[model samples]
Target: MTRIIAAVATAALLLTSTSAFAQAAFPTRPNTLQGQAACAGYTVDNYKERFAANSGGPDVQLHSLCAGAYNYYWMYLNAIRKGFSESDCNVTYDAFDKAARVVTNFWAETH
Candidate 1:
């Protein structure tokens, strides 16, 4: 009976630890600006492919916003890797954030 109890306790401990580790592995939000931009782009692309196929994908406004966000994300990332000043990268980062926000909002509204 004691052995069975010990085994059950061990199993319970393992289950609890596994759940905690899994939760830590997945964050609720993107931790990096580039990650956020990619998420925005993915959402926008999914929307265009799934919902706007008949209408020829996203409208001009959304396409412009999403494309600009994706483009700026890569540019900003490259600039940072190349040792650009934070001040210089700020403008690009803001542009990407703004466009990403618009894309996210549009996606939320449509779905």
Candidate 2:
């Protein structure tokens, strides 16, 4: 009985440690557009609402990846507004264009 209890305790400890490690690893921001947008708290709904408000049109529909790319572009604009160098924000434009192209291509294919 004691041996069984020790084994169970060991298993629980291992699981707890692994879960902690995974949680720590999960939220790391990679040096990429999607990663940056996620770190900045951008979400699909936020993107949709902002796009509609800015365009004076209906809500824009986007896949999660596409929305994230757009959010990254928005982040670049925000950075510019906050006095960041345009050159520093230029990389995000490429990322946004790539994502937008993918979405546009998919739409073209579908319709």
Candidate 3:
């Protein structure tokens, strides 16, 4: 009975530790600007592609352009948040550039 209790306690502790580690790994919010910008840029790229394929009208295009601009601005904001130096921001810019390239590549392949 004692051995059984010890094993159960050990399993419980292991489970609790694993849960804590998982929570720590998850972000509470957008803490890094560059990461957030990369996510937003990817989202904008998807929107642009959809708009290109099935544009509603000028209004839709205008909205898509504005959204892309917003994500581009967010990239700079994220770079600042991440304490990126002017030169280091090239990394952040590269993320945005890569997102655009990915979308363009998909478009080229599809249409």
* Of candidates 3 and 1, the better by TM-score: 1
lDDT of 3 by residue, 42-105 (tens): 3423545644554567445333533443354355344445444444444334444444444344
Tell me the tens digit of each residue's lDDT in model 1 across 23-82: 122212221423443344344235345233424554655555455456555554544544
Leading candidate by TM-score: 1
Our model 3 lands, by Cα RMSD against the true structure, at 16.5
The top-ranked prediction according to lDDT is: 1
Better of 2 and 3 by lDDT: 2
Minimum summed lDDT over a 10-residue window in model 2 is located at: 19-28
Predicted candidate 2 versus true structure: per-residue lDDT over 1-111, tens digit per residue: 344334334433443443221112112123343434222334434766544444433323434445545665565454444443344344444555555565555545654
Q: List the residue pairs that clash in candidate 2.
A: none
Alpha-carbon shift of residue 53 in model 2 (angstroms): 16
TM-scores for all candidates: the values are: 0.46, 0.43, 0.31
Pick by TM-score: 1 or 2, better one: 1
What does the lDDT read for residue 55 in candidate 2?
Answer: 48
Clashing pairs in 1: none
- Residue 78, candidate 1: Cα error in Å is 1.5
